[model samples]
Target: MKPSTHLVLLLANAASGMAVHDDCKLRFLELKAKRTHRFIVFKIEEKQKQVVVEKVGEPAQSYEDFTACLPDNECRYAVYDFDFVTAENCQKSRIFFIAWSPDTARVRSKMIYASTKERFKRELDGIQVELQATDPTEMGLDVIKSRAN
Candidate 1:
């Protein structure tokens, strides 16, 4: 007489993960929000080749007021959303655009207002940008050929 031993093994699907559906394929790099922090998002769609920018959480009110207060040709810092005269105040001022990285595709676009002149000077030295928001609820941005009068 001979005894036979049999075992059954089970395997899970390789694609399934938390919150991931079997039907939906894995996304390359998707933007995910963590905590709600006062930030801005700037987005440039490659497919459309269009630029859109907006602020999230809290509006840069201080920065807005500061820029608005500048007299004609008095804004020494570079302008992104608003158009200002650049003459005597700014000896060398230029707009800088930074491309999005693969991991940072979903980051919020924002610029913090420097409380002190030294902080403002530091900001001028390094111009950092975030992913522009596209949602209407966020912030509405119109691409104007010229700065709004």
Candidate 2:
């Protein structure tokens, strides 16, 4: 599939929402964090055809669980620093996560519920992550491996 196709799935999850399987909630959260951001730029390596995610923001919670759930073949890494910039009374914070696969991406097909924070702080204060399926082939590494067997 084309790179744009993968991007379309990411955008759709950001705009609407993703429906992730019960077993893949953690992976879905990781992808949601990567896809939806507080404005960031990506540098894709043409020769390797890999996407590197970068952002300028403050440190928030990490998605280690999400990363650990990824397929063994997929490379997952994230870095965060303090760079909060806000003018309103509501304090602004941000986090960045990325889910990159060598040949495909993960796609979800149900309305899954997720939150960054365990408890609801406020209506707008709660943190969330979601996963949406781009295509049938976008299942996480584990799913692919299981199906292959």
CA lDDT of every candidate: 0.24, 0.31
Overall local distance difference test of candidate 2: 0.31
Predicted candidate 2 versus true structure: per-residue lDDT over 30-146, tens digit per residue: 433553322222222223333333332222433333333344433232321112334554543433223233334222211111121111112112232222223324444344333
Tell me model 1's lDDT, rounded to 2 decimals: 0.24
lDDT (Cα, tens digit) per residue for candidate 1, span 7-121: 1111111111112121111110111122122222333222332222332323234334422332332112222322234545543322322221222222211111111112322
TM-score of candidate 2 relative to the true fold: 0.19
Indicate the TM-score of model 1: 0.18
Identify the runs in model 1 with alpha carbons over 4 angstroms from their true place: 1-38, 59-100, 103-149
| Residue 137 shift from truth in candidate 2, angstroms | 28
Provide the TM-score for each candidate, comma-separated.
0.18, 0.19
**Residue 36, model 2: Cα distance from true site in angstroms:** 18
Model 2 pairs whose backbones collide? 19-110, 34-97, 105-138, 106-138, 107-133, 107-138, 108-132, 108-133, 116-127
